[model samples]
Target: MMRPVVYGALAVVLAVGPEMAQTRPKEAASVPAKSLADYSEAMENLAEAASPAVVQILVQRVAPVGQGDSQHMGFVAEQQATGSGVIVDPDGYIVTNAHVVQNARHIDVKILRVDERGQAPHGHLLPAKLVGLDSQVDIAVLKIEGSNLPTLSFLNSDTLRQGRLVMALGSPLGLQNTLTHGVVSATLRQLKPESPMVYIQTDAPINPGNSGGPLLDIEGRIAGINTMIYSESGGNEGIGFAIPANLAKDVYLKLRKDGRVRRGAIGVIPEAITPALAAGLGLDRDSGVILSDVAPHGAADAAGLQPGDVLISIDNKPVREVRDLALTVFQRAPGDELKMVIQRGKEQMTKTVAVLERKNEPNLLEDQASYDAALVRQLGILAVTLDEKVTAILPDLRRLSGVAVAAVPAEYAGLNPGLLAGDVIYEVNTKAIASLDELRAVLNEKKSGDAIVLLVERMGQLIYVTATPE
Candidate 1:
């Protein structure tokens, strides 16, 4: 006999767990724990335990008339984007990638309704509402109305050792309740050099529709959220990434409660200490992070921290890299005291500083100067050419015939980084957009899942913004 993984409290509204009769585990399996002969069974057991919590997510937005792709891509007013999610709270709260549901005017969640014997009946769709989103972490919270919904167990990802068995569960390409098996290939895989968060790398065959689904450990506990894949063939080739459960937990809790995140900040940019700098600064090893710049009036400045100071540690955690200090500080709340040890000149000193609320900046715009315009609404933004009417409202934009965002839905505001009403988009992937037709041509050549770059001009300043088509 087999047993399913069941959960309780702040659990879920769907009542998805196996019936009470099957709640109790059967007699111990004959196979030894984690043995080669038992691994297959382990995977099966994991699937049985976690399947109830997996859900298919559908995000549909009504495209504006005549706004379809140029290649006769079959214009349809209502198009759907699909992904997956896992129930976390008994009250029907679910967790998924922000991109999976962003820009959707309508959100629907499909659950595998289960019977007493843990057998799934035909799944059903339930209307869901977006609770909160944390773009930086790529996590979102959604809610449906129900009670006693089964939820996945969250494990401490810090203890996730590489080479351990884990399962990726989700709907891939609309195939629901699918399970893929693999071992954690690496831990703490940094996606970008300067990114504050890192991912747990796996080989679990994650694909387009798998985003936001649970990556589970052998014990049927959620280890991470399978996010993306890297493949030359545009399919999973054993390289996949998942956000650690701890980070997801933090984001979901804050988003469900506050609907927004206010990350803490200390206005100081640090760089890894170099040999030359170490020699120039005096006798010392090239260790710890050294502040290269300090923002005026920011928390670091208020705490008397200045440029050229070496940050030895924060809150007792050694800071040898920029991310080391950044991840620690950014996760803290405003006014949280940070005990810092620093080396300024030859004097070693300690300082206690309060974290300041990080100020929100417009999406980092990379498109500077000017380009073209379009009526493309792929990224949930209705855009038009920066024509005479737009220039009259903002004289600074008069010279550039760029694509100006005309409108955006309030719920999906933060997803399109660095874009706003009236800002002109001048470039895409380095190609200049000089007219509406040019912008349409560039966008039409691309497909979903391809990342595009836009150089935006706002308030006489040029910045590059990166976004993907929905």
Candidate 2:
């Protein structure tokens, strides 16, 4: 079983190149006689409009490595990173890739103010604080205290036409104010290992340090954020991808309000419907996502969406991949109900599923504990307060009490009588044990010869065990 906590928060920032320019005007002789003047004027206006909003980001960080007594690894001393960002709001809110400033302790945002001559001679450098970061979307927002800074507006990504002229502006390989022009090579390009959604594919040279930069349409509206280049040499090879501005806006708003994106889960495993699998299951040649497992009493299970059932749609939108279904459901608020289309055998069925607030599950860690003998006074795993998921598996557990065993060490081996990994300790010698401190106090009351009894819940069964002090 996958532990589910492996996806750590890390946003990927992407950046651009110079002959493959997107907005460069061809020689007058090469252009059609009609609309030639308008095209040149529009290209000039775009460069004038978008240059002020893009900023460069410099970050410094420090990290710790290895076991005890190991030296501290410093992001500041070991390496330095540079990337680009866009000004999202007038109040100095900047949007960039999370990887640009990962673990950054200090961030500097430089806003370039172009002079009347179209030259960026002067600028202001401001420090920014991280607002929130989402690795799933590879986006992060930072807020700085500044005034009169320019901001860019996002255009609807759906309106972006394939092969439309697009401009990419950012620092590439530490070269500041570098500009590259190219067309939207393709739309709906899929990204992997993190974001499964589509990206805006461009042939523009997206190079290092161009990450977090803006991908602009001919009208100068922001289309996507420069994100990645699919290349073997780790350099641009005419293929790059940018997270669409529409999706970036969605992630930005969610991260700003909730401090994290809460994805709705119906607690069901979805299996992809392939041709062979569909034929084996007697399904249509082309149809829906198959439910492999239904978590009992979960939103999907409660809605009568059973295992092996084909989920065709949610709220009228076609549900193809599990990611698509997940994104569709999470766009709504908790407690909102929506229609779900499912197919069982040869019959198509519909059900309404209520969206529930996503609950955050933290890795269980034990509180500090001490031993009277062996002089072992190290803080180790103790117990944890029970939750709905834990209580459902352990029956006969009272509503108000029980601490799940989280950790154990070799020094505390004698205390491992009835305590197992999932065992919940409810009480210590009839004294209530809610938190680790309470259990520690009760255990401390023991004399050298007194027997200590612990009430524990092991796999839905409650039992009591006693042990003598060392």
Candidate 3:
């Protein structure tokens, strides 16, 4: 019989004897017992005790407009997707991945039940509703109403150390309550531009339905939430990533309180100080980020940072590159106060900047020196230009305007690294761009050294492309 892994609030220290013991027999006698030490062995204990709290999520999602439904039927087709979730509160607050329950019209949650052999696996199915979802971090909270519901306590994910033993609990490929063991492969991985910007990379085998499942340390503490995988085979190739539980908890609380996560930024376009720029700026080292521009009324503007300023640190963390600044600022909430260190015109200064939330709409930056119009165009295509080899297999995209392929001219070589011309341009940067004028309007404010995020639509697929203008 299969069972859900044990997840609980207080660490259970197994004693040498029956009643007081939470520690396994092999544990060193002098070491203090913390939680369930043998994750694999604790699987059955958690399954037997906490199985009712683990749930199998089934979502019925409405098909999109062009999703190939028979028009004569008069009803859009519904799609079903499966994933795993954990009940986090007795009031029925459940936590899962935002991508898992995205667009779900109906959600069914199945709790585990004990069989005759004393194995607890999937059993009862109940209805649930979305409480809040934060797509940026890929975390979602759900709730089901009932009395005496089982809940799991959140562990301090920040305490997790790299190379520590851990386990992943989820329904991988619909295998309810499956357990896989691994070590903390890596930590603080930045895979997205969004806030709470860190992930716990693990070697644990995670599958499609494993999204939103818990990544538990050996002591049974929730370390992260399994989210994404880097795979070409469309399956786990031993490379999986999870949103660190600390970041997830922060996002969860924000989502629970405000129904959305509000992020803050310094409002200055930043880039890693290259060797050339470092030398041009007369810097001793190329180990800091260069402040490119400060937008009008932007946070950095109010803080008095200038375009030529070299940003060395933020909140005491060295800003060696753009990713460092991005990941640091993204971890902050809107309205949070931040300390920055900058070198400006032969003088070093410190400034306190009140980070501000960026608007959902695009804020164009003016650059009269460059092109006639500095605009961000949304083409809604996720594509890269065909290389000599790829051109043989992919068709050519020409004569499309308003939004078209981004040419890889000398200055634009690294703009859209992974996109090709055949990819349809659906969105210019982040602004929804339907026409060339809209793209132009958005770009009127764009300047050099800005990393533009383009949302592209290609081959009926959507992808985000990050480009920086030279």
Candidate 4:
């Protein structure tokens, strides 16, 4: 009935009759067969060329004691974690995910070494210092003391298209210098509504330790920074997301220059024009974005922009959706003028709006915190004394003398008193506490199973929280 197929060194030898072979087209028979060995060699070369730029990141931070049990809460412990990063500069600038080094007291980077034979040996470990971080985009810049290091250049991610071949290089699951190949599944993928940031989606096998790695294009250029994945089982299920290279590069430069990213905003609330909204408003087509409200005395209000104005474009770019306008304004620096084309009540007019610096929120104190010596083990928080420098950032402080919570270590998240970053610790057991030493002294006096009461100011509201230190 059926003949068995035989495999050959170059191609599969299907059993075919003389008649079948005679019926084959001459043009098809004249074509040369490509060898898989060539592709394998190409991939090998690419990996060898790019592996040196991929680094393994080691972090040590304080965290909560227990894994999941509620009884083990209110205790702090130290933990070690591993992630990945890519060297972006010859003088030792590295880029990684901000979450990788969150609350990290110590950070080490392992750089792969390529021998003369083009073979990768064990990586050299070096201490790394955090340059700056932007949590919103989950990007951080680090510096290692070195020069003439191997680095990967960032690709123009806007030119990256769907189905373009790409590779993810990182320490996935603690396996250093690992490389996985895939294609760009999607571009400009927005996971949140009305969010200014977008991601490049890929089908690469990204995992836990792959965070902060580089997603490289076929040419071995950095397409994006591997940030996260969409998985239900905690392991890779093929869907992974990365921060676009353009955005990452912008943040890296800003952080390097100012030690922070200052976002600009024009005070206007934009909403996507839905079919239902258009039907109810009875003004324009059910597409593009509309200004729902303009803040009083804000840049938009001062520029004569009002509610019910449909945004046609901003800075010569079409504003088809809310994110378009949001991203454009978010990328602008304060004092930059935005040339806007708006449609208001059947009349199209141009308006120039000035961008204003958006004030930093209280939660951003974690990014500003650099005091590892301020760790309060009993309270599971890094407390900063409210000096002139700290008080300057916290201008609305009701009282200027209380210690501000700089960060809650990842391990000690569920610890006693339930403290958060930006929270000011004012009193302990009705006794006023002013500095880190005073808070530590108060917390150190308590033993295991002793009840502790903390008076904390959060977002301008004072509240009392009670807990027992383990």
Strongest candidate by TM-score: 4
Go through the candidates in order and give each one's C-alpha lDDT.
0.77, 0.71, 0.67, 0.86
Q: What TM-score do all the candidates reach, one by one?
A: 0.69, 0.66, 0.64, 0.84
**Per-residue alpha-carbon lDDT of candidate 3 for residues 41-93, written as tens digits (9 for 90 to 100):** 57666544544666779888753343243443222346888999887778877
lDDT, candidate 4, equals: 0.86
Ranking of predictions according to TM-score: 4, 1, 2, 3
Which digits, one per residue and each the tens of the lDDT, describe model 4 over residues 1-470?
Answer: 13333235224324566666576655455553344566678889999899988899999986667757778765556789999999999999999999999778899999977568876477889999999998888999999988989899999998999999999999999999999999999998999985898999999899999999999998899999999999999999999999999999988998888777777889999998999999999866998899999999999999999999999988888889888988888777788999999999899999999998775365666677654577776777777888765665566778979898888766566563688778888999999998888988888889999878888888889999887988
Q: Residue 195: error of model 4 in Å?
A: 3.1
- Per-residue lDDT tens digits of candidate 1, residues 362-455? 2311111111122254554556665554454445553567776655534344345657765778888988787767887898888888898888
Error of 3 at 271 (Å): 0.9
257: Cα error in model 1, Å:
0.6
* Candidate whose lDDT is highest: 4
Which of candidates 1 and 4 reaches a greater lDDT?
A: 4
Sort all candidates by lDDT, best to worst: 4, 1, 2, 3
Better of 1 and 2 by TM-score: 1
RMSD of each: 14.0, 12.3, 15.5, 4.9
